[model samples]
Target: MLLEPKSLDNIIVGLLVDNFFKWYVAPKDLWFLDRKKQADAYIKKFKEIGLKNIGNKIEEVDERKGIEVLDENSFIEFIRRINKYAVSTNELRESLKLNLLTTSKQDTFYSFLPSLYVNVDKRELYSLYPEPASYEDFVPKNWSGVYEDFLPKIDWEEKYWYDKNGIDLLNLENNRGKK
Candidate 1:
């Protein structure tokens, strides 16, 4: 899974769902203090973190693995699920967008490119299925080429504001205040 800290809700949901699989579906003893307790903990954390308000049910995600995070095949399925809950309420969609800062003037940091936002985030592998150990499992050939061509399309200066001038401008006000 590629995780963007900017998408806290998505990350939390993904982690809880993953933990649920490790605790119950796989029947791993060392994964938690107890399976039931672990499930409850996951639920509580979800609620505490405000995911429940967004209609993200921590209990509902199927534990069966082999789910691709973002690919052509999985994109359709992911959109269907998102529409089921997201389309019903306008407020929820806005909340989600706001939470992700998808419309921030700063640039799109979180993209729902298949599932939810691709931010050049680092990838980690956690699967319930006996698949390849990491994201290497789903990566297509020409991966480097994909990055070279596709990544450049996303203007990093506009999106992440990492340029030296941008950094200096961002800190200018604070630096002046300190002086």
Candidate 2:
């Protein structure tokens, strides 16, 4: 999805805030609690720190700077301004790699690829599938042959749709048993 610059900025800030809580606050403050309790405590701390209102501060800065789009430097600056506990820019960039940012360009813009895809390198994003304990667990025994047969024909280059004719193929498959 194409996100507005402000929306993207908000998301980045949120990640920074969450990271701050996870690394700085959680260990010292919420460690003894269960996962659910820790999450509740994290929310309380997040609100108490005024991090929730950081979006307004960001807007003011963006308005003053006349920044319609956020590039790497500007993004880093935003994170630094909002998050006093933020890690170094290099560390931030390393964390963002594949997790939030991708090298894939949509036209002139660097696209933020979804989590399902990993940015393997500067040139490509690879699909991240779950690792099943066995081949039968990954795909049903009945569908294994069909899955293998069609896997190679999948168009990996198509970012949005693996198989361009997937819907047609699916319809054909669905109708096969019916007829």
Candidate 3:
């Protein structure tokens, strides 16, 4: 039976497929031989990342033991479940600052803010919308374990955008008297 693609095996396969196309298919390399060879490099990377037991054949992906395929309904249900448990960036940051939350709950760092803008600085409304987990600022577990080995070198005050092209619509800072 198919299930939501949340399982580790599914995630790995998704990553592999994405990497394969990025390294081969998208480059417009018309030669099948060249593309196939490029795909081999990605396969090697997948294997090096502990998927060696999955065998050496990419064509055998479906038969893989740990492969848990998700159906349409199940995928929707999984997304709903994730959203139900997710917390906003504000909530997550506050909780982390107070030590009420741990990095283990990082998956719940939701950031889907609403498109509507409330033009008020002192009377700002609490955003009821939660962001998708795919946001760059919303880190997930599938990431390389490289970051775990070192302490963060950047100070929080440096300021940066985590969501791509996401910006404040209200411009509240400069809109106080314009109303």
Please state every model's RMSD to the true fold in angstroms.
15.7, 19.9, 17.3
In candidate 3, what are the lDDT values of residues 68-97, reduced to their tens digit? 322222333433332323333344233323
**lDDT (0-100) at residue 36 of candidate 1?**
39
Over the stretch 48-140, how does candidate 2's per-residue lDDT look in tens digits? Answer: 987664322212232214333223223344344434333332333333343334333341122222112111111111221122211122221
TM-score of each: 0.23, 0.17, 0.21
Query: What are the Cα lDDT values of the candidates?
Result: 0.28, 0.25, 0.24
- For model 2, give the 10-residue run with minimal summed lDDT: 22-31
How many clashes show up in model 2?
0
**Which ranges of candidate 1 are over 4 A from the true structure?**
1-70, 82-133, 140-153, 156-158, 161-165, 168-179
Report how far off residue 24 is in candidate 2 (Å): 12
- Candidate 3 least-lDDT 10 residues: 21-30
Stretches of candidate 3 off by over 4 Å are 1-42, 46-53, 56-75, 100-179
Q: Where is model 2 more than 4 Å wrong at Cα? A: 1-66, 84-179
Q: Which candidate leads the pack in TM-score?
A: 1
**Clash totals, every prediction:** 2, 0, 5
* lDDT (Cα, 0-100) at 172 in candidate 1: 16
